[model samples]
Target: MNLAGRKVLVLGLGDTGLSMAKWLARRGASVRVADTRTGPPRLAELKRSLPSVPANSGPFRDEMFADIDLVAVSPGVPLAEPSVRRALDADIEVVGDIELFAQALPERHARIIAVTGTNGKSTVTSLAGAMARAAGVDCEVAGNIGPAVLDALMRREDAGRAAGLWVLEVSSFQLETTASLAADAATVLNVTEDHLDRYRSIDDYARAKARVFSGDGIQVLNRDDPRSLAMALPGRKTSTFGLDAPRHAEDWGLLERGGEPWLAQGANALLAVREMKLAGLHNAANALAALALCRALGLPLQPLLAALREFKGLPHRVELIGEADGVRWYDDSKGTNVGSTVAALVGLARLDSKLVLIAGGDGKGQDFSPLKEAVARSAREMVLIGRDALLIEAAVAGAGVPIRRAASMDQAVALAAQAARPGDAVLLSPACASFDMFRDYRHRGEVFRLAVERVIDAPKH
Candidate 1:
């Protein structure tokens, strides 16, 4: 952990890379930055903030790895890159921001609650953080959900604040270079096919997510996801959360009381599902996972339940934005892969009505076959857009739902509005990346929201 006078190469000058460089420099490490893009988004900020640090842009070269003591890689930069592979072959210590944060935890005196999975990481992380704060604990949520871990650490240090608890929403990409994050409580919410473009297979992606349980901390696993349940290690303390009833006293699940589902721990019902502000069964599972994680730290149940009841859920993930003609409109642009969209579809399935789904984007090489059953069961019509519209269309061709194509988000929204009936819902849950047609998922969600607003104000034709 002694970084003084050590030479470090910071790869990919994004927020993570910049944080790494600043943190290293503060520790007296010799820092240099290299990014594949000639003009990385944060390159100017880096120059102004750390003018002395050397930075190079464009394609990475072998020389960047020379004489480097450590390579702090951004999650966006794959380890498969030639330069990163070269560093590994040379026995150079390569790590991500999370690993560095883990190494610095003793100085911060903070307990970690790490959450990772293909979906619901952000929701669970935010909820856990809220639970801790509601209990009067000084907690900060970071990693993939907010500011980079190192940035949060530095801000606390400069402000002379004692770190209390850290709730992190870690991605599988961050898990790749992280080895020593011994979280006090951790959970792999669920793992489904995602980021296949970077990983060799679904197994590879799942393995990265499993790294969150590296320490002897208590593991909170998803009982519904076999992939998540498989991560439990021998002799490790574990808890489980699912939509079904809990069998163990410490596990979290649901129970039926008065013919309605209630969130429960073991056989004891805690809160009715209708009491929660967040929509969908998936969010109920997320709330259970958050409760399990917070409860593992021995946080009081009352505040945790209070946080869950007050939680509005995150934007761009099954957020209900507008209602027009009795057709509800949802923006789930964060459904950037097959599993998320599948969850959204299954979570919102109604017996009285169906969904008019707006989906399609980069697709990210996911097998859209899993979506077929969900679509057939939930959707009345489909409006596709983005680069892989045809691929998605072909995959769900026999879902017994009408599929239409649109050139833009506006067109997609119009088509969905047209297809939806008074009781039906219109959802923008593109099961693919937004880079093909939009800057990012938030941008895509914003566009969808604006388009929905337009429909809501169109004189109700």
Candidate 2:
């Protein structure tokens, strides 16, 4: 991991790139920072972080790779691009920001919990961080959630920093180039076919996600996921969990008994599920994973119980937008894949069994058959929108289901509301990306919230 006398070039001048550049420069590696967006305004903050290295703008120069030993890529840059491809062929060692951070951490006494999944990765990572902090253990949470991993590492480098647990939310792209990163504990929350356009096969993407964990460390998995269950994760004591697993060590959950969520450890009762502030079954799974992670580290359970009782939830994750006229509106923009949408569908319980499913968006080359079945079995009606509307409609239309199409979120939400009745649930769980109709998932969720607000704020005539 020593960078002394080595020449490293970091592609992309965003947060991760700057962090990589700073870390490499501090380690005595000659670093070059480049970005496609060439302007001082494009990278003002990054320049402040590295004043010595003149911000070199534009694509990777052929001459830069002439003497460069390795190249660290920012997560935003697609690896399939011709520029990135040429650099790889030049024999330069390319790694991600996470791998660079892994190189700087101490080898022992610190447990790194790496979490990856198509959905719920952010919520699970944040919840895990909250649980660890509540337990009074020295823990720092970073990576994909919000703060950059390098920033977290820089914070640790301050005078008299203590040893603590590091919780990271990793993505598929990051995992692909992330080698030699052996986490003390890791969880593949669930895996489904996602990012198909980027990889050769769905198996390739799953393999990339699986590499987040080391063979020797503990692997926490979702037993409900067949793909996760089928993987032969060797060299580690496996800690498995599902909706049905007990709340014991290596297995955790809150089982419902007589209208209450009960925390059970192998047939023994531990706590009540009613005491938790988190809503829905997906959150219960997240809470279970956090509790299991704590148990794996032998941390006391009281703090976890306290945190679970207080933690509310994050945005865009099956969050309740409004409930008017006994009809519930849900915002689940984070369900960016069919597997995630299916997970959302399974947990929703209805008294009259009426559900209005809002789906479709930018296509990700995923198989729509399973999603189609879930919609057919659960949805009373379907509201399709976004660029992939035809693909989704074609998948569900053969099931003899009724569908209403819209050109925008406002139209779609209004149409769904008009098509729903009392006791019916309107779920905005697009099984694809939000890039076609909106800025990002957050923007999509915000639009959903606004639509619901309009419904809730209407006159009671």
Q: Candidate 2 residues 1-461, lDDT tens each?
A: 88888888788876778777877888898887777776633377766766777567876577766677888888877778676788788767888889888876765357788888776788888888888899897888899886889877876786458558999999988887787777877888888878888889878888888887754677788877776666546666778777785655547765667776676656655667657666567777777777777677777888877887888778888877788898988899988888788777766643335778899898788877787677777788888998888888887767767998998888988889888889888899999999998888999999989988997787887
The collision pairs in model 2 are 247-264, 261-273
**Model 2 segments more than 4 A misplaced:** 37-42, 56-61, 82-90, 245-249, 253-256, 259-261, 350-352
Q: Which stretches of candidate 1 lie over 4 Å from their true place?
A: none
Clashes of each: 0, 2
Poorest 10 consecutive residues by lDDT, candidate 2: 345-354
TM-score of each: 0.99, 0.92
Error of 1 at 314 (Å): 1.0
Candidate number with greatest TM-score = 1
Query: Could you tell me which residue pairs clash in candidate 1?
Result: none
Q: Give the winner by lDDT.
A: 1
Could you tell me the TM-score of candidate 2? 0.92
